[model samples]
Target: MEFFPYDVKELFKQIESKPNLWNRSAHEYRNKEAREHDWKAIYTHFEPNFDKMNRLDQKEIGECIMTKWNYIRASFMRTVKHGPPTRRPYVYYDHLKFLLKSDVKAIDAPHLDNNDDTLEQIPEKKLKVSPFLDEDTEIF
Candidate 1:
């Protein structure tokens, strides 16, 4: 015996009693009636657009289209080898400002080959710096 949240028999009985009203706005009714329709009926659907200038092979053309669409679907539009790249979408700065601040990297810190005091190498000389003083000058 299988279990369902709603009674299947009762739902069907309700459908038999009073048919549901036609909801024109409903997405469920859209292009659904012809879902099982033959795709080849659409002319543009089979057109070789990927290799426009090159001599197209029928097998390669279909494979290219299928790969873009269905073959190993998880990778979608991206090639599997170029696995989902690390992208910083929402940035604190604008694209131009971000490019200007590209020198600062979180983990790309300057390292010394010698296992010496990297911090002590810097002379403790206090200097007052202000962005308002010189806009052209870059801070280290």
Candidate 2:
């Protein structure tokens, strides 16, 4: 669970070298094309925008990377705790980067408050339900 700060950078380099680490059938079919497209999009999105991002935004992205790095490390720990896979190296670093980048936007989300709740409180609806419910009903 202890992720070094450079882990993400190392992962990016590894992913660039070995883009098809997962080796799914879908990857065999389309990964080359898809990976190119994904890389292009990532570059387009991040390259020019890098300088525009504030220090806070960069910090948020770093936090996201750390969070996902720890999560993947924890998963690896669990995998080892249970048993080794028939194959070695069950997860790839790119998988962790993918997870981190996917969630990075949420970490960088702006804290603007919409005016919906400024004037008045929205009424809460009360649902009538029996405290003791048999196994038939689902709460959700």
TM-scores, one per candidate: 0.20, 0.28
Off by over 4 Å in 2: 1-52, 84-89, 93-140
Q: Model 1 residue 53 lDDT?
A: 34
Best by lDDT: 2
Q: Least lDDT summed over 10 consecutive residues: which range in candidate 1? A: 93-102
Q: Which stretches of candidate 1 lie over 4 Å from their true place?
A: 1-43, 46-56, 76-85, 89-140
lDDT of 2: 0.45
- What's each prediction's clash count? 0, 0
Put down candidate 2 lDDT per residue, 1-140, tens digits, no spaces: 45444455554554434444322333443557765554444333434474467878755654555466456556644443344455464455334434332222222212212242322222344666887987688878
